[model samples]
Target: MSNVKDTTKANNQLIYAKRNMWTGILFGFGIVAFIDEAVFHQLLHWHHFYDKSTTEIGLVSDGLFHAFSFFATIGSSFLLADLHRRHAFWLKRWIGGIFLGAGVFQLYDGIIQHKLMRLHQIRYHVDVFPYDLVWNITAVIMIVIGIVLLYRTQS
Candidate 1:
């Protein structure tokens, strides 16, 4: 009987961790997108989301991006609520997921968008190298923290 109970508990933990991880990823992506759009695109006025196009097109693109991020956040919220209802959500794991997601999104933008696609640099009218270095380094740090947290949760 004790053995059966222990097995059940372990199984439950694994199940919860898996579910929470997915939720964390979605939430993470949404958060990163929100921050990038809000900070880089708006507050700093670094560069529009789509600068290759006209101003009207850039604004339209930003609107679409905002909409996507909003939907992702909404989806994450619903999933989190379901997890809470089941009493299976793990805060540490969820946080880890957020860090992972944010790092991934940032890295993707830094490497793929800014580097490969030439979409836009970190800032247009400034020294781009410093900004890019700082941006990528931050992303790496977040990813490392996320990895550590998620690994700790396994115990």
Candidate 2:
């Protein structure tokens, strides 16, 4: 009986941890996407989500990207609320997940989108090396922070 009870408790903890981590990931991704769209695309006019075409198409692409971010944020908020209601929220784990997700998203944007896919550069009329270096390094730092926190294994 004692062993069975212990197993069940451990399983529950695992489930809670996973839930918290995933919720944080979703939230982090959405927030980063929103920031990229608003700051780089709209405010600075550096580049659009898809800049392979005319300005009008780029604006439309930005709109779609914004919508995706909005939905991700909203969905993650609901999941987080559910976790809170169930008394399963884990703060440290959630934060770790956030950093992990943000780092992954940023890295993807910097490498795949900016380089491989040729979606857009960080800036149009500037040397791009510095921008790329800073972006990737920042992403790596966030990923390290997230890994450390997530692996601490303490509630």
In candidate 1, stretches whose alpha carbon ends up further than 4 angstroms from where it belongs are 1-11
In model 2, what are the clashing residue pairs, if there are any?
A: none
Model 2, span 58-128: residue lDDT tens: 99999999998999899989998898776667778889888988898999999999999999999988999
Give, for candidate 2, the lowest lDDT window spanning 10 residues. 5-14
Q: What is the lDDT of residue 97 in candidate 1?
A: 86
Give candidate 2's whole-model lDDT.
0.88
Report every candidate's CA lDDT: 0.85, 0.88
Per-residue error for 46 in candidate 2, Å, reads: 0.3
**RMSD to the native, candidate 1?**
2.9
TM-score of every prediction relative to native: 0.90, 0.90
Question: How big is the positional error of residue 57 in model 1, measured in Å on the Cα after superposition?
Answer: 0.8
